[model samples]
Target: METAEKPNHIGRKIGRIRELRGMKQETLAEELGISQQAISKIEQSEKIEEEKLEKIAKVLGVTKEGIENFSDEAIFNIIGNTVTNHDNSSLLCFQPNFNPIEKLVQVYEENKKLYERLLKVEQEKIAYLEKLMKEK
Candidate 1:
Protein backbone atom coordinates (compact mmCIF):
# COMPACT_ATOMS: atom_id res chain seq x y z
CA MET A 1 0.00 0.00 0.00
CA GLU A 2 1.06 3.53 -0.66
CA THR A 3 1.88 5.81 2.25
CA ALA A 4 -0.44 8.69 3.08
CA GLU A 5 2.20 11.24 2.22
CA LYS A 6 2.43 12.38 -1.41
CA PRO A 7 5.71 13.66 -2.75
CA ASN A 8 5.92 17.45 -3.30
CA HIS A 9 2.52 18.08 -1.84
CA ILE A 10 3.09 21.72 -0.97
CA GLY A 11 -0.21 22.19 0.82
CA ARG A 12 0.31 19.22 3.08
CA LYS A 13 3.79 20.43 3.88
CA ILE A 14 2.42 23.85 4.82
CA GLY A 15 -0.18 22.32 7.08
CA ARG A 16 2.39 20.15 8.82
CA ILE A 17 4.76 23.05 9.32
CA ARG A 18 1.94 25.15 10.72
CA GLU A 19 1.00 22.39 13.13
CA LEU A 20 4.63 22.00 14.19
CA ARG A 21 4.59 25.67 15.15
CA GLY A 22 1.56 25.07 17.37
CA MET A 23 -0.75 27.03 15.07
CA LYS A 24 -4.37 26.41 14.32
CA GLN A 25 -6.08 26.80 10.98
CA GLU A 26 -8.11 29.69 12.33
CA THR A 27 -5.00 31.43 13.60
CA LEU A 28 -3.21 30.97 10.30
CA ALA A 29 -6.26 32.28 8.49
CA GLU A 30 -6.31 35.35 10.67
CA GLU A 31 -2.62 35.97 10.04
CA LEU A 32 -3.13 35.68 6.29
CA GLY A 33 -6.27 37.82 6.36
CA ILE A 34 -8.25 35.03 4.75
CA SER A 35 -11.24 32.95 5.80
CA GLN A 36 -10.61 29.76 7.74
CA GLN A 37 -12.13 27.80 4.88
CA ALA A 38 -9.53 29.25 2.54
CA ILE A 39 -6.81 28.09 4.83
CA SER A 40 -8.34 24.64 4.83
CA LYS A 41 -8.45 24.59 1.07
CA ILE A 42 -4.86 25.65 0.87
CA GLU A 43 -3.91 22.75 3.09
CA GLN A 44 -5.78 20.45 0.77
CA SER A 45 -4.07 21.76 -2.34
CA GLU A 46 -1.24 19.95 -4.10
CA LYS A 47 0.41 23.14 -5.32
CA ILE A 48 0.44 26.80 -4.33
CA GLU A 49 1.59 29.90 -6.14
CA GLU A 50 5.03 31.15 -5.23
CA GLU A 51 3.77 34.55 -4.05
CA LYS A 52 1.16 33.06 -1.77
CA LEU A 53 3.71 30.55 -0.51
CA GLU A 54 6.07 33.41 0.33
CA LYS A 55 3.39 35.18 2.35
CA ILE A 56 2.48 32.02 4.20
CA ALA A 57 6.14 31.28 4.85
CA LYS A 58 6.60 34.73 6.39
CA VAL A 59 3.65 34.23 8.71
CA LEU A 60 4.84 30.74 9.64
CA GLY A 61 8.31 32.00 10.56
CA VAL A 62 10.01 29.82 8.00
CA THR A 63 11.65 30.26 4.65
CA LYS A 64 9.65 29.29 1.55
CA GLU A 65 12.35 26.74 0.76
CA GLY A 66 11.93 25.29 4.21
CA ILE A 67 8.24 24.75 3.66
CA GLU A 68 8.82 23.31 0.21
CA ASN A 69 11.30 20.82 1.65
CA PHE A 70 9.40 19.84 4.81
CA SER A 71 9.04 16.19 5.65
CA ASP A 72 7.88 14.15 8.63
CA GLU A 73 10.81 11.84 8.18
CA ALA A 74 13.28 14.71 8.51
CA ILE A 75 11.60 15.85 11.69
CA PHE A 76 11.58 12.34 13.10
CA ASN A 77 15.24 11.96 12.29
CA ILE A 78 16.16 15.17 14.04
CA ILE A 79 14.28 14.19 17.18
CA GLY A 80 15.41 10.57 17.06
CA ASN A 81 19.02 11.60 16.87
CA THR A 82 18.83 13.99 19.82
CA VAL A 83 16.51 12.18 22.21
CA THR A 84 17.88 8.96 23.71
CA ASN A 85 17.49 6.78 26.78
CA HIS A 86 20.86 7.19 28.43
CA ASP A 87 20.25 4.38 30.86
CA ASN A 88 20.06 1.72 28.12
CA SER A 89 21.82 3.59 25.33
CA SER A 90 18.80 3.27 23.11
CA LEU A 91 16.65 5.75 21.25
CA LEU A 92 13.67 7.15 23.15
CA CYS A 93 11.43 7.95 20.28
CA PHE A 94 8.47 10.27 20.61
CA GLN A 95 6.65 12.94 18.67
CA PRO A 96 8.85 15.32 16.76
CA ASN A 97 9.52 18.68 18.42
CA PHE A 98 11.76 21.66 17.96
CA ASN A 99 15.33 22.04 19.09
CA PRO A 100 15.15 25.05 21.38
CA ILE A 101 18.46 26.54 20.27
CA GLU A 102 17.64 26.07 16.62
CA LYS A 103 14.22 27.60 17.16
CA LEU A 104 15.87 30.56 18.90
CA VAL A 105 18.15 31.17 15.95
CA GLN A 106 15.24 30.94 13.54
CA VAL A 107 13.28 33.40 15.65
CA TYR A 108 16.25 35.76 15.74
CA GLU A 109 16.54 35.69 11.97
CA GLU A 110 12.82 36.34 11.55
CA ASN A 111 13.01 39.17 14.04
CA LYS A 112 15.86 40.73 12.11
CA LYS A 113 13.75 40.68 8.94
CA LEU A 114 10.79 42.12 10.82
CA TYR A 115 13.00 44.85 12.23
CA GLU A 116 14.18 45.78 8.77
CA ARG A 117 10.63 45.93 7.47
CA LEU A 118 9.59 48.09 10.42
CA LEU A 119 12.59 50.34 9.94
CA LYS A 120 11.60 50.91 6.33
CA VAL A 121 8.08 51.85 7.32
CA GLU A 122 9.39 54.29 9.92
CA GLN A 123 11.74 55.84 7.39
CA GLU A 124 8.86 56.30 4.97
CA LYS A 125 6.81 58.00 7.69
CA ILE A 126 9.68 60.34 8.44
CA ALA A 127 10.00 61.22 4.80
CA TYR A 128 6.29 61.96 4.58
CA LEU A 129 6.47 64.16 7.66
CA GLU A 130 9.40 66.05 6.22
CA LYS A 131 7.48 66.59 2.98
CA LEU A 132 4.54 68.02 4.99
CA MET A 133 6.91 70.30 6.87
CA LYS A 134 8.39 71.60 3.64
CA GLU A 135 4.92 72.18 2.12
CA LYS A 136 3.77 74.21 5.15
Candidate 2:
Protein backbone atom coordinates (compact mmCIF):
# COMPACT_ATOMS: atom_id res chain seq x y z
CA MET A 1 0.00 0.00 0.00
CA GLU A 2 1.29 3.46 -0.96
CA THR A 3 0.83 6.49 1.26
CA ALA A 4 0.11 9.89 -0.21
CA GLU A 5 2.56 12.76 0.35
CA LYS A 6 1.39 15.88 2.14
CA PRO A 7 0.78 18.95 0.04
CA ASN A 8 3.19 21.90 0.39
CA HIS A 9 1.97 24.86 2.45
CA ILE A 10 2.00 28.13 0.54
CA GLY A 11 2.17 30.31 3.65
CA ARG A 12 5.20 28.45 5.00
CA LYS A 13 6.94 28.82 1.65
CA ILE A 14 6.24 32.55 1.65
CA GLY A 15 7.56 32.86 5.19
CA ARG A 16 10.76 31.10 4.19
CA ILE A 17 11.30 33.44 1.27
CA ARG A 18 10.67 36.48 3.46
CA GLU A 19 13.17 35.18 6.03
CA LEU A 20 15.80 34.43 3.40
CA ARG A 21 15.44 37.93 1.98
CA GLY A 22 16.15 39.47 5.46
CA MET A 23 12.71 41.05 5.81
CA LYS A 24 10.97 41.42 9.14
CA GLN A 25 7.27 40.74 9.57
CA GLU A 26 6.78 44.39 10.55
CA THR A 27 8.52 45.53 7.37
CA LEU A 28 6.30 43.34 5.23
CA ALA A 29 3.25 44.52 7.13
CA GLU A 30 4.18 48.17 6.52
CA GLU A 31 4.62 47.48 2.80
CA LEU A 32 1.30 45.65 2.63
CA GLY A 33 -0.47 48.32 4.73
CA ILE A 34 -1.39 45.73 7.35
CA SER A 35 -0.45 45.05 10.95
CA GLN A 36 2.50 42.91 12.02
CA GLN A 37 0.06 40.58 13.75
CA ALA A 38 -1.71 40.11 10.44
CA ILE A 39 1.60 39.15 8.83
CA SER A 40 2.22 36.65 11.63
CA LYS A 41 -1.21 35.17 11.11
CA ILE A 42 -0.64 34.94 7.37
CA GLU A 43 2.62 33.09 7.95
CA GLN A 44 0.84 30.57 10.13
CA SER A 45 -1.98 29.98 7.63
CA GLU A 46 -1.81 27.10 5.13
CA LYS A 47 -3.41 29.00 2.27
CA ILE A 48 -3.55 32.69 1.34
CA GLU A 49 -5.79 34.65 -1.00
CA GLU A 50 -4.45 35.00 -4.55
CA GLU A 51 -4.48 38.81 -4.54
CA LYS A 52 -2.70 39.07 -1.18
CA LEU A 53 -0.21 36.39 -2.17
CA GLU A 54 0.67 38.29 -5.35
CA LYS A 55 1.24 41.48 -3.35
CA ILE A 56 3.48 39.65 -0.89
CA ALA A 57 5.41 38.03 -3.72
CA LYS A 58 6.04 41.42 -5.33
CA VAL A 59 7.28 42.93 -2.05
CA LEU A 60 9.55 39.90 -1.55
CA GLY A 61 11.05 40.33 -5.03
CA VAL A 62 9.66 37.04 -6.38
CA THR A 63 6.78 35.92 -8.55
CA LYS A 64 3.79 34.03 -7.11
CA GLU A 65 4.87 30.90 -9.06
CA GLY A 66 8.43 31.30 -7.74
CA ILE A 67 7.13 31.37 -4.17
CA GLU A 68 4.96 28.31 -4.84
CA ASN A 69 7.90 26.30 -6.29
CA PHE A 70 10.75 27.44 -4.01
CA SER A 71 12.77 24.78 -2.12
CA ASP A 72 15.60 25.42 0.35
CA GLU A 73 17.06 21.96 -0.24
CA ALA A 74 17.24 22.56 -4.00
CA ILE A 75 19.03 25.89 -3.42
CA PHE A 76 21.52 24.23 -1.07
CA ASN A 77 22.13 21.36 -3.50
CA ILE A 78 22.77 23.76 -6.40
CA ILE A 79 25.22 25.87 -4.37
CA GLY A 80 26.99 22.79 -3.00
CA ASN A 81 27.46 21.26 -6.47
CA THR A 82 28.54 24.52 -8.07
CA VAL A 83 31.27 25.39 -5.54
CA THR A 84 32.96 22.05 -4.86
CA ASN A 85 36.76 22.00 -4.99
CA HIS A 86 38.90 19.17 -6.34
CA ASP A 87 39.10 17.68 -2.84
CA ASN A 88 35.27 17.97 -2.51
CA SER A 89 35.61 20.76 0.03
CA SER A 90 33.27 23.78 -0.18
CA LEU A 91 35.50 26.84 0.29
CA LEU A 92 34.45 29.05 -2.59
CA CYS A 93 36.36 32.31 -3.21
CA PHE A 94 35.51 34.78 -5.96
CA GLN A 95 38.02 37.12 -7.61
CA PRO A 96 36.65 39.85 -9.82
CA ASN A 97 38.70 41.11 -12.82
CA PHE A 98 38.50 44.79 -11.86
CA ASN A 99 40.40 47.17 -9.60
CA PRO A 100 38.70 47.62 -6.18
CA ILE A 101 40.00 51.17 -5.79
CA GLU A 102 38.62 52.14 -9.20
CA LYS A 103 35.21 50.82 -8.26
CA LEU A 104 35.32 52.74 -4.96
CA VAL A 105 36.29 55.95 -6.77
CA GLN A 106 33.44 55.49 -9.25
CA VAL A 107 30.93 54.98 -6.42
CA TYR A 108 32.33 58.02 -4.57
CA GLU A 109 31.89 60.18 -7.68
CA GLU A 110 28.28 59.11 -8.06
CA ASN A 111 27.55 59.87 -4.41
CA LYS A 112 29.23 63.26 -4.74
CA LYS A 113 26.97 64.17 -7.65
CA LEU A 114 23.90 63.15 -5.69
CA TYR A 115 25.03 65.15 -2.68
CA GLU A 116 25.56 68.19 -4.90
CA ARG A 117 22.05 67.88 -6.28
CA LEU A 118 20.58 67.56 -2.79
CA LEU A 119 22.52 70.57 -1.58
CA LYS A 120 21.19 72.60 -4.53
CA VAL A 121 17.64 71.63 -3.65
CA GLU A 122 18.12 72.58 0.00
CA GLN A 123 19.59 75.94 -0.99
CA GLU A 124 16.62 76.63 -3.23
CA LYS A 125 14.23 75.77 -0.41
CA ILE A 126 16.10 78.07 1.97
CA ALA A 127 16.03 80.90 -0.58
CA TYR A 128 12.30 80.49 -1.09
CA LEU A 129 11.71 80.52 2.66
CA GLU A 130 13.84 83.65 3.04
CA LYS A 131 11.93 85.35 0.23
CA LEU A 132 8.62 84.61 1.94
CA MET A 133 9.94 85.94 5.26
CA LYS A 134 11.02 89.22 3.58
CA GLU A 135 7.59 89.59 1.93
CA LYS A 136 5.89 89.16 5.31
Q: In candidate 1, how many Å is residue 61 off?
A: 0.6
What is the Å distance of residue 4 in model 2 from its true position? 3.8
What residue pairs are clashing in model 1? none
Model 2, 74: alpha-carbon shift in Å? 1.5
- lDDT tens digits by residue: candidate 2, 1-136: 9999767788889889999999999999999999999999999888999999999999999999998888888889999898756763433555679998999999999999999999999999999999999999
Best by TM-score: 2
Pairs that clash in candidate 2: none
Top-lDDT candidate index: 1
Cα RMSDs of all predictions? 18.2, 12.0
Q: How many steric overlaps are in each model, in order?
A: 0, 0
Instruction: State residue 90's C-alpha deviation in candidate 2, in Å.
Output: 9.4
